[model samples]
Target: MRPLTEEETRIFFEKLVKYIGENIKILIDRPDGPYCFRLNKERVFYVSEEIMKKAGNVARENLVSLGTCMGKFTKSKKFRLHVTALDYLAPYAQGKMWLKPSAEQQFLYGHNVMKSGLGRISESVDRYQGVILYSMNDLPLGFGTAAKSTSDCRHSDPGTIVCFHQSDIGEYIRSEDTLT
Candidate 1:
């Protein structure tokens, strides 16, 4: 694995900033020890410095992966954040949505969240903004983009889509064969 180039870092951070906002600083300067992002076979990995050091000794050709796979850079150079990055994004997410128990299953099945399934939403959420979805009990389930602003949601019909499905934890099982 190798460090991301300046252009790659900018593209990656732009996508990440949409979900985590300025909390990117906290990720870079964490109290738990230094961490870094490395690229291997187009996949970005978030690894602790200690592990990174050990990984450095491995031949690049033989190092299949190292650290958490944050996401991958598509052939078009666009970065796509993976569900594997959900744990890091959840804590720093700027917009959050909570689903009702009844709707939890629907979302896990890869359906967009409908107004009827929404239990609560952050006041600052805006149309098309990135949002982290959680259960009513506060379990982070996935991440998606808001389909409507907070104000718009209040007046929308129950069947209206509130959040567009992107990646979710359920994919871990449902698409296990396809995931890297």
Candidate 2:
């Protein structure tokens, strides 16, 4: 693994900022210790400074992965976040949407959330904004982009799509062998 170059950092942060906003500072400057992003085989990993030091000693070929796999950089140079990033993104998400119990199963099955399934939404969310999807009980289920703004949602039909599905925790089981 190696440190992300300036260009890579900019691209990665641009995508991350959409979901977490300015909280990116909190991620890098945590009270406990400093953490950073590293790249290995196009996949980005979030690792603590101390762990990064240790990892540096291992041979590159043998170090398959280290720390939390945030996501991967596609061949086209775009970043695609993985479900593993939910833990980090949930706490700092700027826009959030809660799913009704009845709709939870639908979302987990990789379907886009419909207006009828939405239990609640952050009033600040705008159309096409990145949003973290949660269960009624506040469990972070996944992340997606809003298909409609808060006001549009209130007036739209129940069948209208509210959030577009991206990545979800279910992916861990559905694609177990490919993760990491």
Candidate 3:
């Protein structure tokens, strides 16, 4: 992968910080390796439609791709955050454990956003869609935090414990007898 331009780096950092603050999770199923993020949603909803839009712009302007495949390949592409509570806490305070995203990954991310918009216009059926928050349960870890994931192995990754389906109400629901 090529080096990220200054702006790409800046946007990447912003995204990382925002997700971390919002407890938003990011999942990437890449050829190299699958990754997941458990973010902190303590202060506020850092990511907004506007931010997503900007991210879209950044991808187009910089020629970055968010994911390997764009919405063109699929219909009604969904964008959602899957939440899960950990029996053991994340390694934030532990330090070093937190990983920085590479330039290619960030580029691919920007592409995902752009594809969402194109998806709306590209298909007559509006097949390319947006993110879908699934299976959210319980409050954020800290007073102002949320959580997200990046799953690849599938087995090792935790399934949805919480979700952001209702952005306005911040609704969280339990799955069967899982959380109790």
lDDT digits (tens) for residues 1-180 of candidate 2: 889999999999999998999999998898998898999889999999899899999988788778899999999999999999999999999999999999998998899999999999999799998999999999999999999999999999999999999988899999887687
Q: Give, for candidate 2, the lowest lDDT window spanning 10 residues.
A: 171-180
lDDT of 1 at 163: 99
State in Å the error of residue 16, model 1: 0.9
Q: What order do candidates take by lDDT, descending?
A: 1, 2, 3
Model 3 quality (TM-score)? 0.19
Work out candidate 2's RMSD over C-alphas. Answer: 0.9
For each of the candidates, the C-alpha root-mean-square deviation to the true structure, in angstroms, is 1.2, 0.9, 20.6
What ordering of candidates by TM-score runs from best to worst? 2, 1, 3
RMSD of 3: 20.6
lDDT of each: 0.93, 0.93, 0.23
145-173 in candidate 3: lDDT tens per residue? 12222221122223322112212111223
Q: Identify the superior model by lDDT, candidate 1 or candidate 3.
A: 1
Q: Judged by TM-score, which candidate is best?
A: 2
Q: Higher TM-score: candidate 1 or 3?
A: 1
Off by over 4 Å in 1: none
